[model samples]
Target: MNKRTNYKQEKRMKELEKQKKKEAKKERKLNKERMETDGGEIAGQEEMA
Candidate 1:
């Protein structure tokens, strides 16, 4: 019984880590897009003006 519970706990920890990594990747992509849009547009607009 102890072994089985430990196995389940380890599996859960792995799955949680995987999920956290996926979320971090998604957040990075989102931040990249935001930075690109926010940073580039100001310079582009200034150039236009």
Candidate 2:
């Protein structure tokens, strides 16, 4: 019983790690896109000025 519980805990931790990594990757991509668009907007404003 102890071994089985330990195995399950290990498996669950691996799954959690994978989920967190995926979420972090998505967040990073979103931030990158926002940064890119912000730069574009600034350039556009500068050109208008």
Candidate 3:
């Protein structure tokens, strides 16, 4: 019984870690896209000036 519980606990921890990693990756992708758009707008403004 103890061994089964330990295995389940470890599995849950691993799943949580995986979920956190996926969220972080998604956030980074969004930030990168935002940066690209913001940079392009800034460049365009500078050119107009």
Candidate 4:
């Protein structure tokens, strides 16, 4: 019973990690699009700073 609970916890952790990664990827894609539309210049300036 203890082992089974541990296994479930591990699985839950992996699922949470996957969800976090997915959200991060989505955020990055959106940021990229916004930067492109606003102008790559903004990103370039940020890099310089």
Candidates' C-alpha lDDT:
0.94, 0.95, 0.95, 0.89
In terms of lDDT, the poorest run of 10 residues in model 2 is 1-10
lDDT of 1: 0.94
| Candidate 4 accuracy as TM-score | 0.70
Q: Where is model 3 poorest over a 10-residue stretch in terms of lDDT?
A: 1-10
lDDT of 3 by residue, 1-49 (tens): 3546588888999999999999999999999999999999999999999
Query: Taking the tens digit of each residue's C-alpha lDDT, what string does model 4 give over 8-46?
Result: 888999999999999999999999999787787777789
- Candidate 2's C-alpha lDDT? 0.95
Task: List model 2 lDDT by residue over 1-49, tens digit each.
Answer: 3546588888999999999999999999999999999999999999999
The alpha-carbon deviation from the true structure for residue 12 of candidate 3, after best TM-score superposition, in angstroms, is 0.4
Q: Report the lDDT of model 3 for residue 43.
A: 100
Give one digit per residue, the lDDT tens place, for model 1 in 25-46: 9999999999999999999999
| Cα RMSD for predicted model 2 | 3.0
Candidate 1 vs candidate 2: the lDDT winner is 2
TM-score, prediction 3: 0.87
| Inter-residue clash pairs, candidate 2 | none
Candidate order, TM-score descending: 2, 3, 1, 4
**Residue 21 in candidate 1 has what lDDT?**
100
